[model samples]
Target: MRKRYAAQNLLFISAAVVLFAITSCKKDRTTTNNNTPVTATPTKLGLYEEAQTDNDTVYREVFITVTQIGTLTVPDSLSDQVFDTGSGGMVIDAHYILPANMITSTGFNFTGDSTVVDGITITNQKHIIQYGDDNNSTATVSGNLCYASVTIGVTNGNIVVKRLPFYMYYKSVDNNGKALPPHEFDVFGANSGYDVTFPNNAFITSPFSYFDPGTGLTKGFKMAALGTANFSDQNEVPLTPDVITLGLTADDLSSASGFSMSQLTESPPYGYQPYIPATITYNGTIVNDASILFDTGTNADNYLEDPSLNSRNAVVLPTNAAVSVSTTSGFKYAYTVGKLDNLTYVENPQYSGVPVSIFSLNFFFDNEYMLDFTDHKLGVKSN
Candidate 1:
């Protein structure tokens, strides 16, 4: 009787131990912070090819989406600077118009996800377009939409990136209206990198003024364009006007000797007073009666040539021609130029002055020029 009673008690204790062990494991798993779910690695969206309009509008009209965040390497001079992908990213925008037939889908899974992650915010954005009526000088069209919030590391020289990942989605349909399978961008990764660097400090002055669109208030803008130049066609011909204007010496030309500035043949544009007369030598040829404007509102590299200058100066560059640039400060750089056919030149009747040619991205990036917004000056270095 004693042995049997002991056996029964042993069995009961073993079952209780098993039950306790099972309950403890369930409790630990449910409360553990380490078990939180993480988002899966993203994939790239699509690839694009450069396209042109009948009027010579140049666009990268291809469809693409970023699937991953990849590393961007900068110049060795900046090698000491460590850029964190999660926190140091900047917003990237592609202002483009898509085709009517293009198929698109929103990743519902990402809908409420943090628009900003590790300093990267990927979001959809738009711009407003005000069309001009018949009474107005010109009519406007729809503005562009883009994907924003990609982070980047700014380095000198060529940007060297090894593992920047982009997850994008795309689709093509058959003759029927049925939808096709979605595909991600895998090839666009090759051309997605950018090269950024700084220039010599001596070339520019500081305490620049910038325009705040949000405030509509003019404040000190830290960035400035060193000068402006125009692009030529594939044949190396100037796409627009040949006459170059030199804004008065206060901007740059004051101390430099050579050439002459003259009063305008007619009342100049509304905001512009007669520039203190000046002339400049361009491409070894002396040009007079030119209007020079150091426009901060302009992109610092290459911009579309004004249409008013179109018929005025159409000097073609030789096939595979290279254009050289020089400034009164003795800054110099050169690049092969290409024509932008469809870029429209806005000729506002209220502003009767010939459009000021813009020197923007083409020149800055090609020349390895850099703008220090914090210091408020433009700098250039050898490429």
Candidate 2:
């Protein structure tokens, strides 16, 4: 029997159990290979929805890409199997056919029957889908897969499987170590990819009305991080609704990976929030000129550390300030963050928590943005 788990309201984190702040930060939008488009046509797309985990409630969507391995026939009925995007849907436990050319990391375990023919490797793998707006959101897939010989794709390229029965195993504790009941729901799958571009003034013209079916949560796109960081330690505990975090410290940035501490920052604490060349604006005001890590996975909420240092103020605007953000590509977007939302902040011992002085914003799919891994750029969609 599956261990039943009770769902908890985890839309936002509790102030008492402060874990870590997750944000994705990238360098200023730079068009590499000058004059080339930075967006990739998404291979697949599915409607976004919210799910409840033991620790939190998350917005999730799944994308699938099926390629022919040899001569195996994938049922034509596969495309008809899509999951509902309703609030009550269950978390998906779907499988993926590992591509022969794909290089997987140590994060996954392979299982079940496997066969290789014609220099093609066929294996079943499990991939957990999350509501993500980044280019590398679905890069890592985990699970023990079971399958037989497969065929290589000849005609069908991508398929969006919707409204299907999907089950996920979950267990929770009532602040004590007690087991919870099992749950189930339906899910959909499809080939997932992002085709985004950040042309000038894109943020000003994009849509911001996003309604969360699970909690009736509505939000608009307001700000974006110039860069992002997940964790200093790759093996750190994962957030319930896993997200792409902003990269802090000198080591987090790919461009400054080889720099020494002395070459990174010249602060009293040295390396305490190694600088990032970024900026932030609130209601047309340049409140922050550097060190702001915009988080899209959360909400339009803002945080201000009590008794913040002058340097901290230089990078993040106070919660009392009018709320909004403008992008360098010439796009102006606004949001609403209440004045009472200020967090009685404290620094993190792990150097992993959202810094008391650092600012975090939520704008996942609130406004369309194209994430291009090929060019290492996050382009705000201006259509």
Which model scores highest in TM-score? 2
TM-score of each: 0.27, 0.31
lDDT per residue as tens, model 2, 1-383:
00010111112111121111111121233345775433322121222122323233222322121232223333432322222211111232222323333323332233443344333322332222222112112111122221222221124332212111122212222323333232121122110111011112010001011111111111111112222232122222222121211112212223433211112222321111112333444435454443422232222234332222343222334455565444443445455544443222322212212322233323333443322221233334222
List clash counts for every candidate, in order.
63, 45
Give the candidate number with the greatest lDDT. Answer: 2
> Per-residue lDDT tens digits of candidate 1, residues 132-170?
111222211111111222222121111112222122223
